[model samples]
Target: MKIGDPLNRSTDHGPQNHKAHLDKLLEFCQMGIKEGATLVYGGKQVQRPGFFFEPTVFTDVQDHMYIAKEESFGPIMIVSKFKTGEVDDVLRRANATEYGLASGVFTRDISKALYVSERLNAGTVFINTYNKTDVATPFGGFKQSGFGKDLGQEALNEYLKTKAVTIEY
Candidate 1:
């Protein structure tokens, strides 16, 4: 796909923030290929003047694969599959990763979504969406992703002070 411009109203995607990040994303895409993941789509830089990369997709990925485990911080989709009746097993595998910055879940079933989202070990869990966050909600990671929040009420609590007084009953 073409690199989208943020200023343009019709643009849906944009280039990577910098050259180094783009390079790193390419490396991870390549690593996924070498590690036996199937490159289903767009694993190369677009023929343009900016730090643009094709939104890459890797299928046939195992839960243990590095691409599935690490964050690319770029436009990359790593797909892994689980049996239909084994969602708990899938959640277990998803939470096995040490990093818990963000995670995405895509499903039509809201009940199933709530069920899976509750068990995910991430700071922010998105349903049928990614990279979209609300400023009024707590945002941070649970494990090695981070220690503190950057937005929402939890961040405000850091700057607030509350004291309780005991009353005779």
Candidate 2:
């Protein structure tokens, strides 16, 4: 889907938040190219008004690639193919990141799915589905992704203070 004026209900998507963010996303795209990751799809600015950038996709990504290491926070997907039975290796690579906001595991094997969910450093792990969040569920990240959480009871705690009281009769 191409980016267009977000005000239009027909538009599937819109531009980045601002120019700086757009520039950063562009930089990541270039870094993906420079780091030898195969660009499978869009990687250029839309050349229109606002900070529009193409939704990008990169395949054959390496662990050391910038696209693989850092979070672009943009409409970019980096795919790293692994050996058929190398779940441990994949988990290690996924957890090696400094940011641990979210992760997803898609598999028919229940045991494998649970194992990956247990080992991933991200705070949220989606099995079989992606980006499924609810107001009742706490959402946040681990490591450098930031502290505390948002939504759910956990988020409510952030703005509340607990006080202990004792009564003697």
Candidate 3:
């Protein structure tokens, strides 16, 4: 697979949603570099007609870096390393963000997976996978990410109001 025109259908990659999103993605990539994070992969914008950014990856990301603390909402991944014994601190750093939308945990140990998932503040936590959403499950965010659900019975409940009536017989 190669990066080429998405319209070809065979191409493995596509452009960003728009120019603004592409620019934002580029900015975050630059910020990652400026903040001393190592750029492990692509970090350039393609010269094609539509807005496109190279899929990027950053290593040695710090908790305080803008690229680490904020969501890029683009095809960028930041890898932050933590000590094995610092699970508590890592959870705190992960939950410190204003957005509590979704999170993922990839681990072979079920106990560790459950432990972290239980502590993460995000509304959706995926174990051993990522971004697994279904119509059968309620979907929403906590904190500034947003409120209320959009699917499942929980979403249906939003428009319905329960009423009670009492009659003396």
**Per-residue CA lDDT of candidate 3, range 110-163, in tens?**
898899999999888888876566788998888887888889988998899899
Q: What is the TM-score of each candidate against the true structure?
A: 0.76, 0.80, 0.75
On lDDT, the leading prediction is 2
Per residue, candidate 1 scores C-alpha lDDT tens digits across 1-169 of: 4367867856657888999998999899989999999999998988888988898888899987889888887788777766659899999888988888887888888888889889999888898987676688888898888888989878987788899999999
Candidate 3: the clashing residue pairs are none
Instruction: Give the residue spans of candidate 3 off by over 4 A.
Output: 1-17, 42-49, 52-55, 161-169
lDDT against the true structure, each candidate: 0.85, 0.86, 0.83
Judge candidate 3 against the unseen true structure and give its global Cα lDDT, from 0 to 1.
0.83
Sort all candidates by TM-score, best to worst: 2, 1, 3
Alpha-carbon runs more than 4 Å astray in model 1: 5-12, 157-169
Error of 1 at 72 (Å): 1.4
- Worst ten in a row by lDDT for model 2: 75-84
Clashes (N, CA, C under 3 Å) per candidate: 0, 0, 0
Global CA lDDT computed for model 1: 0.85
